[model samples]
Target: MPLITIIGAGPGLGLEIARAFGQKGFDVALVARDQSKLDALAQTLAGEGIHAQGFTADVSVPATITNALQSIRETLGPIDVLEFSPADRTLESVDALKVTMENLQPQIDFYLGGAVTAVGAVLPDMIESNTGTILVTTGGGSLAPTPARGNINIAAAGLRNWTLNLNSALADTGVYVALVAITALIGGGRPDAEPAVIAKEYVKLHAERRDAELHYVAYDR
Candidate 1:
């Protein structure tokens, strides 16, 4: 079976993505900061007949992410798909004028830095094997920025830019890269924005190996 490693795996979209890929014969490796929550999610997937294992890592700490990916490789074999979507639980939004190096740095570290670390860890193997899929998730603010979430927008935009550029860089190679920008409140009463619905897009991106980005917008922004 192929392997998919989901960074920032949680109860929402992460779980659904695990299900979508797991059902398709991909063994799931879930990475998160909370061991208990990760265990619960793995158990849930197991109940659904989807083989999943959880690894704990804090995205803000690059070393932890590197360690977790190494563990995944040792345990599940080389990863076929890498999905990165870690949540920022502590950072609070600051207006554009209030943004500073102190405030913006953490967001950058959490989103952009984390992505670089995770990709760097597994990208070598993917390139050597000549087959892999990389999917990155960011909020709509990355594409359509608002002054209200200036720091977050800046960080997410950096991630988006990198993902697009990576896609172009790997065009000649078998590895595929794409960014997923969620523009609505997931599971916020919109059937179209539900986790399961949005997750299908991830699977499609991996299977088709086309498109550099997907904007999953459920409402007018």
Candidate 2:
């Protein structure tokens, strides 16, 4: 069975994607900094008969993520798909705009550096096998500039461009890279932006293996 590693697995889109991929017959490796949460999620997936394991790692640390991925490979198998998601949004409000540069750096590191580390951990194996998938979850802020979410926008924009370039370079190698840009709130703030609905787009990205980017936006206005 193929393996999918989800970095920053949580209660929202992360869990949704895990379940979505799990339904498609993919063994899952959930990576996050919290072991207890991971255990709970793993248990939940287990109840559904999905083979899932959790690995704890702070995405800001490359060594931790690399070691975790290595452990996952040893226990489950080589990762066929890697899902990159941010653990939290650092600059969440425009009113709280007095944040210093130091605080902002971690957000960039989490989004841009974290993806680089995770991909680097698995890309070599994917290259050797000449087949794999990389899916990045980004926000519409990356597409359109937003002063309120500057941190996320900057980091996500970097990741978005990086994924596109990586896709171009890996096109002939059979390693597909794609980005899912969420244009609205994920959990039904908008009619079409439901988590379940977004999860399908991820499944389609893996199955179709054609598109390099998907914009998931929902509005009821």
Candidate 3:
């Protein structure tokens, strides 16, 4: 079975994504900071008959992410699909006017730096094998700046830009790269914005391997 590594795996979209891929015969390796939570997620997937294992890692710390990916590779085979979507719950967003290097740096480290580290760890093997899929998740703020999440938007935008560029660079390498920018509150009453609904897009992206990005906009504004 193919293996998919979901960084920042949690109870929401992460779990749904795992289920979607698992339904399609992909074994899952969930990476997150909380071991207990990860274990719970793994158990849940197991109950669903999806072979899954959890690896703990804090995306803010590049070393931890690297170590977790190495462990995942050792436990499950090489990653066929890499989905990065870490939620940083510790940092508080500042307004655009209040943004500073101190405030913005952490977002940079979490969003952009983490992605670089994770991709670097697996890209070599994917390139050698000539088959892989990379799916990155960000918020709508990354595409259109909002005053509330200034630092996050900046960092996410950087990640989005890099992902698109990487897609272009790997055009003929058999490694597909795509980004999913969610523009609504997931599971926030809208049927279209539910986690399960959104997750189907990930599976579609991997299967089709055509689009560079998908903007899952389920909001009015």
Write down the RMSD of candidate 3 (Cα, Å).
1.3
Q: Which lDDT tens digits does candidate 2 get at residues 87-140?
A: 564444332265466656777788898899999989998999999999998888
Can you list the residue pairs that collide in candidate 2?
none
Better of 1 and 2 by lDDT: 1
Each candidate's number of clashing pairs is: 0, 0, 0
In order, candidate lDDTs are: 0.94, 0.86, 0.94
RMSD of each: 1.3, 2.1, 1.3
The TM-score of predicted model 1 comes to: 0.98
> For residues 185-213, could you state the per-residue lDDT of candidate 3 as single tens digits?
89888888899999999999999999999
Off by over 4 Å in 2: 90-103
lDDT (C-alpha) at residue 173 in model 1: 82
* lDDT by residue (tens digit), candidate 1, 96-200: 999999999999989999999999998999999999999999999989968899998999999999999999999988999999999988988888889999999
Candidate 1 ranges beyond 4 A from true positions: none
TM-score of 3: 0.98
- Which residues of candidate 3, in runs, are more than 4 Å off? none
Which pairs of residues clash in candidate 1, taking residues 3 or more apart in a chain or in different chains? none
